[model samples]
Structures are given as C-alpha cells and as structure tokens.
Target: MSSFDAEALERAAKAARELESSKHVKAAVELSKREQNVKVREYDARKAEASADAEKAKAAQIQIAAEERRKTIAFERKAKEELMSRQQQMERQRMREQDQLSRQREQDMLEAKKQADMERDARRLQMEQQIQEERLEGARRRAEAERANIRARAMAEAEGRILEQRKNEDIHARDIQRRSEAKAAELRGAIQEAFSQLSSTLGSYIKDSTALRNTVFVGTALAVGVYGVREGSRVIGRVVERRLLTPALVRETSRTAGTFGLRQRMKRALGMLPAEEVGLDGIVLEDKLSSRIVETASATTNTRRNGAPFRHMLFYGPPGTGKTMVAKRLARTSGLDYAVMSGGDIGPLGKDGVTELHKLLDWGETSKRGLLLFIDEADAFLSSRSRSAMSEDHRNALNALLYRTGEASRSLMLVLATNRPGDLDAAVTDRVDDAVLFGLPDAAGREALVRVYFEKFVVRAGEDAPRRLMGLLPAARASKIEIGEGFTDEYFAELAARTAGFSGRAISKLMLGVQGAVYGRGEPTLTLEIMEDVVQRKLAEFDERRRLAKTDYTDSASEAVTGTAADAAARRSSA
Candidate 1:
C-alpha cells in the first residue's frame, strides 16, 4: 500500500491513454486516404466525358469541309464545258464568213475575164476593118497613078512631034538665009570654046567628077553613097580617100565656099532631115567608158573659179561597144551642136575635096558656139604613118589633123571613136586630152540588157495585151524588166547580145529581122513563147555567122603558119 503500489497504478493508466491516442491517429489517416481515392475517381470520369464530346465535334467539321469541296469542283467543271461550247460557235461563224468572201472574189474574177474577152474581140474587128480600108485605098491610088502616067506619055509624044516639024522648017529657012546666019555661027563657036576651057580647068582641079557630085548630094543620095556603097569601085574609092585626104581640107573648103560651102550644106541637111526621136533609159555603158564620160560631163558642167571650157574626151573600143551612143548623149546633155562623120569620108579627100572639108570645119568653128565633132572609125583616117608609104596628099592630111587636135578652141571639141587604136597615128593619140576604152559587158550588164528587152516588148505591146502576156513570162525576167519612158533604149542590148561578134551594121540587120517577125505576125502581142522562138531564130543566125568567121580565121592562120614554115626551110637550105 505504500508508495511503490501507487507508482505502478499510475504507469499502467498512462500506458492505456497512450495506446488509445495511437489508435485514433491510425483511424484518421485511413479515413483521409479513402477520401483522396474517391476524388481521383471523380476526376477520371469527367476527363472521359470531355474527350468523347471533342471527338464528335471534330467528325462533324470533317464532313462539312468534304461537302463544300465537292460543290466547288462541280461548279468549275460546268464553267469549263460552257466556255468550250462558246468557242466552237465562234469558230463556225468565222469559217462561214471566209467561205462567203472567197466566193465573192471568184465571182468578180470571172466577170472581169468576160469583159476583157469582149473588149479584145472588139479591137480585133476594128483593126481588121481599118486594114481592109487601107488596102482598098492603096489599090485606087495605084490605078490613078497609072492613068496619069499614060496621059503624060501621050502629051510628051505630041510635043516632040511638033518640035521635030519646027526643026525641019528652020533648017530649010537657014539654007535660004545662010549669009544672015554667018555672024550667029561665029559667036556660038566662041562660046563653045570658052566653055570647054573652063571644063578642062575644073577637071584638073577635081580628081573625080563623080566624087564631087556625090559629096554635094544630100539625104537619100548621101546616105546611099556613103553608107550603102556595095560596088567594088566605090569600095576602092573609099580606101583611097582614107589614104589621101588631109585634115586641113575642111578649113580651106569652108573659106572658099563662104557660108554656102560643104560644111553649111551638111549642117542644113542634118537639121532638116526627119529623125526618129527615141527616149533611152537605163543605158549603162561599159564601166571604163561610163565612168570617164560621167566624170567628164560632170566636170564640164561644174563652175570653176577660173572660167574654162570642159576638157574633151576620146572613146576607143571594139566595134558595136556603144561609143557613138556615148558621144551623142554627151552632145545632147551639154546642149552643144554635134557633127558626125566617118573616118573613111574625111580621109579620102583629094586637093579639090579639101575645100569642102575645110568649109565644114570653119562652120563648126564659127557658127556653132559649142560644137562637138564625132568622128567614127577614126583609125582609118589616122593610121600609123611609120609603115605607110608616104604620099604628098597623105602627109598633108595627117598634118591637118594634127593641127586641129593641138589647137583647142572654146567653140570646138573633137570626140573620136576608133575600133583599132593600134592603127591610130602617134600624133593623134598623143593629142587626145582624155581616153576611155570600152570592153565587153560583164554578167550584170548582160542581165540588165535582157531586162531592157523584155520591158521594151511590153511597152510596144501596150497595156491589156502586155499585162496578159506578162503573166506568161519567166518570173526571173519579169521581176527585173523595166521599160524606159520612150523608145531610145528599146531592145538594142538584147539585139546586140543576139548579134554577138557582129559589128553595128550587122546588129541593125538582126533588129530588122525581129521587126519583120512582128510584121509577119500582124502586130500581135509578143507572148513569151513567140519571144523565145524569135530568140532561137536569132541565135541560129548568129551561129551561122560565127561558123563562117571561125572557118575564115582557121584558114588564114593555117596559111600564115605554112608561109612561115616555108620561109624557115628556105633559110636553112641557103645556110
């Protein structure tokens, strides 16, 4: 009962209290853990519900976007189909318009062709009627001429009979009155003697009476005698003239005859004679000559500080190289008087003939303020004197030419054209102020010449006919062809080409042949086929001439070679 017992009771009670507290803490902790678990389960359920709703909304949005895309695609496809249909309609409309235009054009062309045919028929009928009328008129005129000639012959016969009867009566009367007629007979004899003396003196002064008469004659006579002399005697005379005449003769003749001398006569005849005025275009001469001529002409026209006349020029070339044409053009462009003559005509003058030549020179020097003398074939008159047998007449003629060439006057200009420059006298060559050599044309020139001919035919055929024919011509030729304003250029280049190796004279013959063809065809439009045929014929003629020339050349060459060989053999034998 004591202090120890009370201490044990207290310890036991304390132990009980401590045990209860520990149990209560354990219970509270367990309760709190259970509440936390319940809160976690509730949060999981709410998260599951939110996830399902979000999934459903997302599916709805996907379906709406798909529907919108499908609608847009359908609209685009409709628009493309509508555009294609509109394009097809427009194409059909354009095609229909083109067909209508094409038909209209065809109709117009047909109508035009019909009109052209009608016009052509009308023109043909008119031409035929005119030709018929002309033939009838010509026949009537020829009949009238025959009747007139018959009447003239009858009148002449009657007059002749009357004259014969009167002559017989006069003879009978003279016998009866012999004493009275004695004085008249003596006077007549004296007159006859004087006339005979005068004739003899004139004969001595003139080498040939025939030459003097021919020189004085003009127009047809001059042309025929100078240019158309085919007789042997005339040819011989021409050769002799080339060897004998002096250049001074022209001056002397002019002085002796005064104003009425040979020079004046020639000038008058040239002026009065009817000439065809032809217009030339695109006439390009050989380069050397063309350049020289153009330069000379330009210089002449140009004004200088020191006043001086233009320098003169000479043209040297093979025959038919257009030297004469250049000279003529120079004179025409410069507004100067032109006097043309042949070397053969100038060189053949005898002492008596000199007077006429001199007169011509004087007229050129005095009357023509600006005069140009064109001497064609000048080499014939001014041949090399070194190999020539000297004659008094020949020496004098050479001296005269030298004097004229050296002495330049404001009024006088000389232009000499020669084919054989080697034959020209040394003095004459030295005196020439300017010299231009003409050679064969180049390829370009030939092409141009062909074009010129085509153009010429077109112009001659006229509008409608030429137009129709032009379509048929070669495109190459048609593109290049150009017609001159007038007839000057004509078809000379083509004619010249056709007459290759031919002289100017021969070329003229070829042209005449072409004209003959045209006439034969009754002046119809010269179609391409017709032109080609004409060209072929011309070529055939040219070939024949070439063959003849070749034959002659070969023969001459063989003869020369044979002669040389013989001479060499003879020399060897002598050695």
Candidate 2:
C-alpha cells in the first residue's frame, strides 16, 4: 500500500485503542464501523453504475454493426444486378454481330460467283478469237506450201531433162567402147585357140609315150607318200602326247568336262553360277583364310583380264585340309580351267619325266581358257636337290619344271599343294608369288564342317527324292532316316569339341561312318547312340594312326643316331 493508506490504517488502530480505554469506546468503534460500511456500499454503487454504462455502449455497437451488414448486402445485390444486365447486353450484341457476318459471307459468295461467270465468258471469247486466228494462219501456211511444192516440181523436171541428156551421151560412148572390146576379144580368142591346139598335141604325144607316163606316176606316188607320212606322224604324235603322256600325270580335271559355252553363260546370267572370284562356297574354311583366298582369286582374275602373267601360288599344310579343293575352286572362280596332278606321278616317269612334263604343259597351253595346274603333294618330286634321295632323273625333271616356269606364264597358273613345304627346293619356292597355309579346322570350323556333312550324308542322303548334287552324287539310295530332336546345334557343338584336331575331310568321313553304321544295323533311324558309336570308333582309329606315326618317327630318329655313331666308330678305326 501507499504511504497514505498506511497512515489511515495506523489512525484506525489508534482510534480502536482509545475506544477500548474510554467508557464510550464501544459506541465510537461501532460508529467507525458504520462509516467504513457506508464507504464500501458507495464504492459498490459506483462499480454497478460503470457496468451499466459499458453494457449500453456494447448494445449501441451491436445495433450499428447490424445496420452496416444490411447496407453491405444491399450494395452487393445491386452490383450483381448491374453485372447481369451488362452480360445480357454483351450476349445480345454478339448475336447481332454474328448475324451481320453471316449476311456479309452470303453477299461475298454471290459477288465471287458473279465475278467467276464474267471471267469465264471473257475467257471463252478470247479462246474463240485465238482459234479463229490459228485457223487463218493455217490457211495462209497451206497456200504457201502449195506454191512451194509447184516450184519444186518445176525445178525437178528441169534437172531430170538435163540428166537424161547426159545419160544418153554416156550410153552412146559405152556402146562404142564395148564394140571395140569385143573385136579385141575375138582376136585374143583366136590366138588362144591356136596355142591350146598346140598344147593339146604335145599332151597327146606325151600320153602316147609309156616311159614318160611311168616316170610321172612314180614321181606323184613318192610325193604323196612322203607328205602323207609327215602329216600322219605329226597328228599321231599330238594324239599320243595328249592321250597317253599327260593322262597318267593328271589325277583329276574339270577342263574336259565342265560348265562351258552358252550353258555356262546362261547359268551365270541367271545367278545360278557361283560368285566370280569372291568366295568359294563349295569348300568351307575360316573367315580370314577364306577372305585371303577371295582376294587372291580376285587378283588372279584381274591379272588375267589385264593380260598380266599368272601368279604362281603355294598351298602348304596338313593333309585333308582342303588345299586341293581350294585350288580347284579358285581356278573355276577365276574363270580358268582346273587340272589336278599328283607330284608322285612325276617320279615314276624317270628319264622321260622331262618330256612328259613338257607334254603336260603344252597340252595345258592348248586350253582356250587359261589353265590352272594344281600339283598335289608337290614335295614328292620337287624336293630339295641337296637330299641324297633325289636321283638324277628326278633332278632333271625338277630342272625341266623350273625352266618351264622360270618366267610368268599367261597360259598356265601353277598352284602347288604340299604337306611339307620345307622339303621343296628353293627354286620351286622362288617361283611362287603367293603362299597360303591350310590349317586343321578349329572348333568353329569343325562345327561348320560337321553341320555340312551331317546335312549331306545324313540328311540329304536319307531323303526320299534325292537329286544329283552338282554331278558329284550321281545316285542316292533313299532311306527312312529319323534323327532325334535332341540332335541340335548343341549336339553338333559337342561333337565338334570331341573331334579335336580333325580335318574337314575327317569330319566328312566321320559323318559317312555314321551313315554306314546306320545302314549296317538295318535300322532306318539314326540316333545319338549310333552316331556316338561311330564317332568313338573313328576317334580310336585316328588315335591309332597318330600313335603309329609318332612311333615311326621315333624309330627313324633313333636309327639315324645309331647310324651316325657307327659311322664315327668306323672312321676312328680307319684312322
């Protein structure tokens, strides 16, 4: 409390003490209490009066708020009515404007139609005037042409009269010349008759003499005999050379029996023939090797077309690796006649090998289309001269070949295939312009080969209506061969994995064995079991051959060492 309130409280306390001390203290205290009570009642009356004033002010604010809300509603209603009146007016204006536009479009269409009709009439009038002008021009041209034709006819008549006069003069001169020639001919004929009579008398006199007749007959007979003998000998020699000398040397050839002439041209045009110098589909090989062959074939074909000398090639690899096949195919693809010869045949010719070799080359040169001379197993005869086994005759034969092929030839392309390239003489290898290695088929190549042979010997060969395959298979025995569905690409892949180090030819043989086993069992169906059996047998055979080959090689090596040791002992003893 403030200081004033504390003072009042102290005074009240003093008064109460005084009242207690005085005899009228009770009345004084009571009067003081009454005054305090009266003050409290007055304070309460003031608070009540303030509350009543606050309530009146609150009621006045509520009345004012209700009036304001009612005015706001009235204002919103008026604004809404105004907005509706403006929207209705705008809608009516849009409808009137649209009607005006429609009327304007109809009027425009009518105007455009009227304009089009006017333009069409003008165009028709213009066209009629132009046609009339063209007709007048044509009439003027026709009249001029008639005049020109009459002038030309008059000129031609004048020229004809002049030419007729000249022809008459020429004819008179020719007649006079012919009369003179006839007279001269008469004189000549008289002289010729006299000479003919004189010659006839001499011929008659000679015919009457027996001695002259006999001499003439003998001379004629001798001449006829000598000429006949010479010509006969030449013809016989050529026949013998071609028929006997070269036939033994040649192992195979498509030169004599091949697609040729019009038939070959027709087949080529129809896309029936193989691609030209691009790839060989007849034989299968790795892509890289195949591409190289295609390049070589293309080059060879281009060289031939350009009249360049043929390039000699060497194909050296393991046996049955398609060396011979590739050579033959390349020759055909390059438009050259193919001739396959075995080098082994040359060694047996001995002293006559040179003559036979020459004959073969001469015959090859006779091919109208150039020849591709493929020598298989070339090392058989063309081995290194340094070897002791090379006899004089063989050396002579090799020399003959070297001399013949010393220079590039346009008529003959030499392709030598050998299992042992190292054994070839340097001279022989030197003649080669290109060399290719035919390796054993890899997994992919073997798989492809298996698929091919399977299709050929197993599938096609078992067909009911088997046809000739490029004249390779002449006849087919139709067998009801049933192959299992399980025999798929995976099976072939597995077979390829099993047949490691197999050559293409070996795979073909393996398939052929599968066919044989099926036929031998008298079963129409060829199952996986039968094929596996044949494969196993073929594998065993192949292993046995490999083992024998290794054994033979080892034995030869040991013998050579032993022989060298023995020779050294003998030399030491001699010393």
Question: Local distance difference test, per candidate?
Answer: 0.60, 0.81
Each candidate structure's count of clashing pairs: 14, 0
Residues 1-575, candidate 2: write the lDDT tens digits: 64557888999999878767899877877899999999999999999999999999999999999999999999999999999999999999999999999999998997798679869988999999999999999998998999899999999999999899787988889999999999999999999999999999879878777878887899999999999999999999987666434455777776653334456565545554533442587578988999999999899889889887787887877778899878877888888888898899988888988888888898888776799999988989889899997889999999999999877688899999877776778777767766777888899989999998999888877443423544344355667577776798788899999999788989989988988888888666888878877897799898987777641112332233234434543544475
Single out the weakest 10-residue window by summed lDDT for candidate 2. 551-560
Model 1 residue runs over 4 Å out of place are 1-280, 303-310, 387-391, 461-512, 527-529, 544-575
Model 1 residue 87 lDDT score: 90
Best by lDDT: 2
Candidate 1 residue 492 C-alpha distance from true site, Å: 14
Q: What is the model-wide C-alpha lDDT for candidate 2? A: 0.81
Candidate 2 differs from the real structure by a C-alpha RMSD in angstroms, to one decimal, of: 34.1
For residue 527, what is the lDDT in candidate 1? 46
